[model samples]
Target chain A: MNLLLLHPDQRLDGDRWRLDDRQATHVRSVLKLAEGDHCRAGLLDEGTGQAVIESIKNNEIEISFKVDSKPVFALPLNLLLALPRPKMLKRLLVDAASLGIKNIVLVNAAKVDKSYWQTPNLKGDLLREKLLLGLEQAGDPVMPRLRLAPRFRPFVEDELDQWAGPGRRLVAHPGPFPELPRGLDEPATLAIGPEGGWTPFEVALLEQQGFGCHRFGSRILRVETALPALVGALMRLP
Target chain B: MNLLLLHPDQRLDGDRWRLDDRQATHVRSVLKLAEGDHCRAGLLDEGTGQAVIESIKNNEIEISFKVDSKPVFALPLNLLLALPRPKMLKRLLVDAASLGIKNIVLVNAAKVDKSYWQTPNLKGDLLREKLLLGLEQAGDPVMPRLRLAPRFRPFVEDELDQWAGPGRRLVAHPGPFPELPRGLDEPATLAIGPEGGWTPFEVALLEQQGFGCHRFGSRILRVETALPALVGALMRLP
Candidate 1:
C-alpha cells in the first residue's frame, strides 16, 4: 500500500480529504499511521499528491494534500483481451496496471465460459480494488481505464477501428503467419487469444482487418503467462 | 502431474521402477494411483513412456513402463540467468523445465546476493523436485539439465561460446539500447540479469561478446516476470 487510493466520494474541501472504511482501516491498522504522518492519496480520474494525516479513528480518517499532480500512469497502448477466469483476471488487472497500461478491453472469446464474467472480481468496486493494488506496486497514483465487452464480433468490428494504434496490428496465433517486424517503435494494437485460442473463423476475421497472425513460440502458454510476454516483445521493438 | 519424472536411481529394470518415500506418498495420496492405473513416466536423461501401476501398498509402490518414445520438446534456445531469490528460483526451475528448456546456466550476478546460492532449492535433490513438477505440467517425461557456474564473466567468455547458436543474442537490460529485433524464428541464446539487473561493466563485457542489450520498456520488471516476457517476445518473433 504505497499509495492510499481514494474514491471520488472521499474528497472533502480544498486540501482536505476523507477516506472510506476500507482505506481508513488500512491506513490506521496496516500502515499504523498517526496524526502528522504523511501518506499518499489519489482521486479516481482526478490527480495525486501527499496527504498528511489529520486524524484517525474508527473506520474514518482525514487527510490534507496538494491535489495538483496527476495520480496515475496509464499505458501508452490499449489492451483488448479475452476475459480469463477470476483468479487469473485479478492478477492480470494488477500486472497490467503495474506496467501502466492505459486502457483494457476485456472481450468475450468463443470459449469464454459465461460463469467467468459473473466472478466477484469483475464487480466495479472489486476491479478497482485490484487495479489499486497494481498502482500501489508500481508507485503510480493513476488508474487504468477498463471496458467490458461481452460480445466479441461487435467489439472487434464496431469498436476495434477506433482502438488500433498508429502502427501495424498483430494477432498472436499458434502457427506462424509472419515475422514480427523489427525496429517497430511506433505504437501498435496487439491481440492475444483465449486458452483454447481463437478459432479459424475468428482468426480469418482478424486477418481480414489487416491483423497478421503471429506466434511467440511452439509452446502453449496460459493467458496470465502470455499477456506480459506479448507486451514485453512489442515494447522491445524499436 | 502430467508426467512423472524419475531419477536414474529410481530405474530398476528395463521397465520396472521403484518409488521413494516422498514419491510413493505423492503417488498414493495426491494421484491416488491403484493397480492397473495408467500414468506417464520419464527418465532424467532418457525418454518418456507410459507407466502402469503394478501395486500400491504401505510406504512403497511398484510401477512399470513401456519404453518406446523419447521426451524431446526442449526449448529452441538456451537460457543463461543470474540466480534470483530462493522462492522465485524455485518457480523458475519448475517453469524452465515445464517450458522445455534443456540447459539452465545459473551464474552469480553482481546484484545477486551471495546467500541465494545457498538456498535449499539449489541443492541437487531439491532442484530435481521442482524439475519433476515442471515435467508433470508439460506432460513430458524427461527432466531438464541444470548447471551452475559461480562466475558470470568466465562462464560466458569461456564455456558459453561453445553452445552459442547462430542467431541474434539478447540480454535484458533497461538502457537506451535499440528495441529488440522482432519475430525471431531461429535458434538463439538469451541472457537475463538478477533482481537489480546487470552492472555497467557486465553489460559492456557482454556486449563485447556479441550480446545486444534489450529493454522491455521503461518500467522495471522483476526477474521472474522478465523470463516469460522475454521468452514469449523472442518466440513470438518470426
Candidate 2:
C-alpha cells in the first residue's frame, strides 16, 4: 500500500487514529515502520497528510496524523463499461479507481455472461474493498462512485443521455470507426465493451445517444489492459 | 483463449494438428467445440487461420487448419523497464506481448529487490507461457523477445545505446520533467522505473545515454497500470 488509508470511524481523538486490520498488518509487516517513523496517511473522502507512529502493541498501531491537503481533484471523465468477467472486474475496479475516474456505470451488455453478476466480487463491501485498495495505491482519498445497471437497454435509453451531460461521448468499438479524438478539454464519457465487444444494436443505441464509436487500433486488449490505455490516452489529450 | 495457438510439433499432417494439453481442454470444455465446429487458430511465429474440429477422442482433439495471414506487425516501440514484483511481471509479459511490443529489456535498479531476479515466474518456460497467452489474446502469432539485465550500469552504459536506436528515448520519471511528446512516426524507446521510481544516479546515467525524462502527470500508478497508459499515449501520438 502506498498510503495508509484510514476511515472516519478510525479516528481516536484530535489527530490520533488507530488501525488493526490490513493496514495495521501492512504497517507492521510490509513497511516494518518503527514507533517514531512516519508514513503517508489519508482519510477516506477527506484529505491526505503524514502519520507519525506513536505506539504499537498487540497487533494494533496507533498514529498521530496531520491533514495536509485535500484529495486530488477527480478526472473530468466518466466510464460506462460493459460488466467484464469476475476476474477482470476486480482489476478494472482497482485500475479505474487508481486513474481518478469519479463516476462509473457497469452496465450489462449482450455478450456479458449472466453468471458474472452472481460473483461474490460484485458484493457491495467487496467492491468497496477493491476500490479502497486502488485509492491506497494512488495515494488519493476520494472514493469513486460506482453504479450498477444489470439491464442494458433501460439504462442506455432512459438515463445515459442526461447523465453524460455536455461532453465528448465516445464508445470504444472495434471497426472502421474514427480514431479517438484528442484535446478533449471538457468532460468525457467513455463506454468500453465486453470481451467480445458490443453487439451492433448496442452500438446503435449508444450512438443514438451521441456516443461516437472509436477504435484503439486493431489489437483487441483485455478490459484490464484497455482501461488504463484508454484512460491514459484521454488524459494525454491536449 | 481467443485463438488456438499451434506449435510446429503439434502438426499431424500438412493441414492437420493434434492437441492434448490445456488448449485441448479449452476447446473441449470452455469453447465446447463439436467435431464440425470451427475456431480461429494461429501457428506459432507463423500465421493465423481457421481450425475445424475434426475429432475429439481419448482426451485429445484433432483439427484441420489452413494458413491465412501473417501475424500483426510489431509496434515500433521498445520497452526498458525496471523489473517489477513477480506477480506484476507475469501480467506485464502478457500485456507487452498483447500490445505488439516486440522487444523488452528488464533491468535492475536501486529500488528493485535483489530477490525479484530469483522469481520462478522469470523461468524461461513460465515466461513463454505468459507471452503465449498474450499473443492468443491479441490474435497475433509472433512472440516478444525478453532480455534480462541483472546489473543496471553495464546495460545502460554499454548496450542501451545500440539497442535504443534513433527516435524518442524517453524515461518516465516523476518530477519536473517535460510532458510526453506526441505525433511521432518514428520508432520510440520508453523506459519505466520500478515501484519507488529511479534514483537520481540512475536517472543521470540514463540521461547521459541520451534518454529524455517525461512524466505521466501527477498521479502515481502501479507499473502494470502505467505501462499500458504510457504505451497507449505513445501509440496515440500521431
Candidate 3:
C-alpha cells in the first residue's frame, strides 16, 4: 500500500481514526511505523489527509489526522470493459480506480462465458473490496462508481448516452483502422472487449452508435493490457 | 496459444516437425486440430509461417508449414525494469515479449529485495518459457533477449549506453516538471523502478546522463500498470 487510506466513518472521537485489520497489520508489520512518526493517509470516500502515528498495539493502529483536503477528481474517462477472469478482474478494477477512472461499466460480451458473470467478484461487497484496494492505491478517498450491466445490447443502446462523459466514444478492435485519437481534447468513454474479443456483430452494433472503431496496433492485447494503453493514448491527446 | 511458434532449428524435413509435450497436448486438446485441419504457426526467433495439420493420431500431432512472412519487430522502446517478485516478473516478461520488446534489462533497485533477483523466473529456461508464451500471444516468433545486470550503477553508467537505442532516454519517476516528452518521435530506452519507485540519487544519475525524468501523474502505479502506459506514451511522441 503506497498510502494508508481511511474513511470519514473511520474517525472516532476528535483526531483518533480507527483502522481495520488489514490496514492495521500493514501499518504494524509492513510499514513498521513507530509512534510519532508521520505517514500520509486519506479519508475513504472523502478526501486526502495526513495521518500521524499515535500508537501501535495488537492488530490496530490508531492515527491522528488534520484537516482534509478536497479529493482528486478523476479524468472524465468512462471505461466500459468486458470483465476479465477473476484474478485479472481484481487487478484491473484496482488499477483503473487508482489511475483515476471516474467510472467503470462491466458488461457481458459474446466472447464472455456466462460463468464469469456469476463469479463472487460481482457481489457488492466483493466489488467494493477490490475498489477499496484501488482507492488506496490511488491515494484517493472517493470511490469511482461501479456498475455491472450483464445485458450488452440494452446497456449500450439505452444507458450509454447517459453515462458517456461527452466527446469521443471509441471501441478497441484489432482488425484494421485509422489510429485511435490520441490526447482527446474532451472527455471520452472507451469500450474494451473481452479476452477473445467482441464478436463481429457486437463491434458493428457499437459502431452504429457513433463509436469510432480503432486498433491500438496490429498486436492484439489482453483486456487489461489494452486498458492502460488506450487510457494512456487518451491521456496524451490534446 | 493463438499461434504455434517454432524455432528455425525446430523445422524438420519435408512436412514433419518435432513436437514437444506441451505443444503436442495444446494442439491435440485445446486447439482440437484433426488430420488435414489448418492452424497458424510461426518460426521461433525468426518469422511467422503457416502450418497445416498433416496427421493427428499419434501421441504427437505432425504438422507441415509454408514459410511466408517474418515476425513483426517490437516497438521502439526498450524496457529496463527493476526485478519484481516472481509472479509479477513472469507477467512482465510475457507482456513485454508479447508487445514485441526486443530487449529487457532486469536490474536491481534499492526497494527490490535481493531474493527477487534469485527467483527461478529469472533463470534462463524459465525466462524462455515466459517469452515463448508471450510470443504465442502476439502470434510473433521472435523472443525478446533478457539481460541481467545486478548492480544498478555500473549497468546504468556502462552497459546502458551501449544497449540504448538511437532515441531518447527517460526514467519514470514521480516528481515535479520533467514531464514525458509529448509526441515522442524517437526510439527511446526507458527505465522504471520497482513498486516503491526510484530513489532521489538514482533519479539524479539518470538525469545527469540526459535521461528525462517522467511521471505518469501523482498516483503510484504497480510496475505492470506502468509498462504499457509508458509504451503508449512513447509511441505517441513526435
Candidate 4:
C-alpha cells in the first residue's frame, strides 16, 4: 500500500489517529516503521498528508497526521462497462479506481454471463474493500462511485443519457470503425463491452444514443487490459 | 481462446492436422465445434487462417486448415521492464504479447525481489503457454521474444545500448520529468521500473545509456495496469 488509508471515524484527537486493523499490521510488519518514522497517510474521502508514528503496541499503532493535500482529482471521463466475470471484476474495480475514474456503471451486456452478477465480490463491503486497496495504491483519498445496472436496455435508454451528460460518447468495439478521435476537448463516457463484444442490437442501441464506435486496432484485449489502454489513450487526448 | 493456435509440428498432411491436447479440449468443449464447423486458427510464428473441423472423437479432433494471412505485425517498440513478482509476471507477459510488443527485456532492479527470478512461471514451457494465450487472444500468430536479465549492472553496461538501438529511449519515472514526447515517428524503447521504482543509481545508469526520463503524472499504477496504460499512451503518438 503506497498510502496508509484511515477512515473518518478512525481519528482520535486533532490530527492523531489510532489504527488496529490491517493498516496497523501493514505499518508494523511490511513497513517496519518505528516511532519518529513518517509514512504517507490519507483519510478516506478527505485528503492526503504525512503521518508520523507516535507509539507502537502489540496490535495497534498511534500516529499523528497532517492533512496538507486535497484528494486526487477525478478524471473527466466516466465508464460504462459490461459486468465482467467475478475475478475480473475485482481487478477492474481496483484498476478503475486507481486510474482516477470516479464514476463507473457496470451494466449487463449480451455476451455477459448471467452468473457473474451473482458473485459475492459484488457485495458492498467487499466492493469497498477492493476500492480501498486501489485508493491506497494510488495514494488517493476519494472513493469512486459504482452503480450496477443488471438490465442493459432500460439503463441505456433511461439512465445513460443523463449520466453521460454533455460529453463525447464512445463505445469500444472491434471492427473497421474509425480510430479514436484525437484531442478530446470535452468530457467523455466510454462504453466497454463484454469479452465477445456487444451484439449488433446493443451497438445500434448505443449508437442511436450518440455513442460512436471506436476501434483500437484488431487486437482483442481482455477487459482488464482494455480498460487501462482505452482510458490512457483517451486521457492523452491533446 | 479466441484463435486456435497450432504448433508447426501439429500439421499432419497437406492442409490437415490433428489434436488431442488442451487445444482439442478447448475446441470441443469451449468452442463446441462440430464437423464442418469453422474456427479461427493460426500457425505459431507463421500466419492465420481458418480451420474446419473434419471429425471429432472423445479425445482427439481432426481439422483441415488453410494459411491465408500473415501474422499481425509487431509494434515498433521494445520494452525494458524491471521484473515484477511472479503472479504479475504471468499477466504482464500476456498483456505485453497481446499489445503486439514483440521484444521484451525483463531486467533485475534493486527493488525487484530475487525470488521473482525463481518462479516456475519463468519456465520456458509455462512462459510460452501464457504468451500463446496472449497471441490467441489477439488472433496474432507471432510469439513475442522474451529475454531475462537476472543481473542488473552487467546487462545495462553490456547489452541495453545495443538492444535499444537508435530510437527514442525513455524510462518511466515519477518526478519532474517531462511528459512523453508526442508524434513519435520512429521506433521507441520504454523502460518501466519495478513497484518501488528504480533507485537513483539505476536511473542514472539507464540515463547514461541514453534513456530519457518521462513521467506519466503522479498516479502509482501496478505494473500490470501501468504496462497497458503506458503502452496505450505511447501507441497513441501520431
Total backbone collisions for each predicted model: 15, 1, 14, 0
Q: Which one is best on lDDT?
A: 2
Local accuracy of candidate 1 as per-residue lDDT tens digits, A85-162: 888788788777776776788888887889998887788998888888877656576778888899888878877877
Candidate lDDT values, in order = 0.74, 0.88, 0.78, 0.87
DockQ of candidate 4 (2 decimals):
0.56
Show the lowest summed lDDT stretch of 10 residues, model 2 chain A.
A229-238
C-alpha TM-score for every candidate: 0.68, 0.96, 0.94, 0.96
Poorly placed runs, candidate 4 (over 4 Å): A182-186, B182-185, B236-238
Docking class of 2: medium
- lDDT winner between 2 and 4, please give it: 2
Query: Per-model i-RMS in Å?
Result: 4.0, 3.0, 3.5, 3.3
Sum up the clashes in candidate 1.
Answer: 15
Q: What's the distance in Å from true for residue B167, model 1?
A: 7.6
Candidate achieving higher TM-score, 3 or 4: 4
Q: Please, what's the RMSD in Å of model 3?
A: 2.2
Model 4: lDDT of residue A169: 94
Which DockQ-derived CAPRI band holds candidate 3? acceptable
Model 2, position B82: C-alpha lDDT score: 98
Which model, 1 or 2, shows the larger lDDT? 2
**For model 3, what is the error of residue A202's alpha carbon versus the real structure, in angstroms, after optimal superposition?**
1.6
- Give the root-mean-square deviation of each candidate in angstroms: 6.1, 1.7, 2.2, 1.9
DockQ of each candidate relative to the true complex: 0.27, 0.56, 0.49, 0.56
TM-score for candidate 2, residues paired by index:
0.96
**Which is superior by lDDT, 1 or 3?**
3
